[model samples]
Target: MALPDMDTSVGHSFGLEVDGIQIKQISEVSGLKMEQDVIELKQNTADGKYVIKKLPGRPKAGEVTFTRGLTSDNSFEKWIKDCHFGKMSDARKGGAVIVYDFEGNPIKRYKLTNAWAKSLEISTLKAGDTSVLTEKLVVTYEQMEAE
Candidate 1:
């Protein structure tokens, strides 16, 4: 008997892009959730028995958070400011979270639409501390689809 082919691809977490431009040095990505609302319907049958049925309602993708060591790049900060000033047309961006196999081939992709930064936070600074500086960003998206 011959054995069937099995999938053994590993996930790659660091390759991310926004508006087709690659973001660098991202160490962690979290809070990526795709959810759908459930609608319950209670119906009575002719036998006088009531039952509840669950139906899919709408798509509700949660926010995504990115954490990275601070670098010389200020593009993200600029973009956040632009969004704060009500320049949504320019602030909104399309992004993708990609997962690759060990051979460097893309295995999965999560496409994000109309995404904008919800908040940006920097690690606390101390005069004599020797910790690495980091930036954390919270992002919200209008839609997300996995392929």
Candidate 2:
């Protein structure tokens, strides 16, 4: 998939009071394939200091399914509580990098992380298939946790 223009906001995340503690969704004008990695770049304008915030790659297609609403079934909720959260937090360094997408939601208590990648709409959705994009990308975090 080719990169999409720098749209500061590509998707959104939400935290609930039920099994689905946190959720993020990026609309695909094209299609969202699995196994592709997404990165959130944090560049400091003051000194050009930047950090890469990468989310775990999408599980191979068919390994997981996307649903209409947030639920325990969501993979993010199942992997956010691990050390990866700390890693992502550390990457941000001096600022308050808490998950803001789920703004005002108490479920944010679980060290959450969500951000948009440059854009990969031109990419195709393929399962069990690998692409060069996966290499440029890395699984910076494990997964988000579920309530």
Candidate 3:
């Protein structure tokens, strides 16, 4: 039997059912290394602002990505957990998890009473400013077994 194509990278624009309405959501894995990994997501919107970016760098050793309210019973959050847990069977197994919020969503805001909130914010502005905010998700996966 042939092995499943280990997808090292993936990107997609999907709609997640939230509040009984389909909300646009994007997810992506930007960089990867022997040390750690990085993942990103954007949820809820029709405009381009609701998009995720594959950053150009990877995290160092001993790091984890996380999101707020994701532990709750939310569809979007569940999807993300699925991706990281096992659904994303291609991703590096046993790696760090990190979460980010661009517009400060109620769920995963970079704020805490005792925790230090920090993020590497990327400036979306450009010369043409014609870059349409498109929903996209990218991921780097590992080897897969054939069914």
User: After superposing candidate 3, which stretches have Cα over 4 Å from the reference?
Assistant: 1-24, 31-117, 133-147
State how far residue 85 of model 2 sits from its true place (Å): 23
Model 2, 7-121: lDDT tens per residue?
2322444322222323334221122222456666656666686666666655432111223332234333323333244554323211111222323433222221332122111
Q: Least lDDT summed over 10 consecutive residues: which range in candidate 2?
A: 133-142
lDDT of 3 at 93: 37
Off by over 4 Å in 2: 1-104, 112-122, 125-138, 142-147
Q: Which parts of model 1 are misplaced by more than 4 Å?
A: 1-5, 8-12
Q: Estimate each model's TM-score.
A: 0.90, 0.16, 0.20
Best by lDDT: 1
lDDT of 1: 0.85
TM-score winner, 2 or 3 = 3
lDDT of every predicted structure (CA atoms): 0.85, 0.30, 0.31
lDDT of 1 at 80: 89
Residue lDDT tens for model 1, 61-105 = 679998889999996798789899999999999999877766566
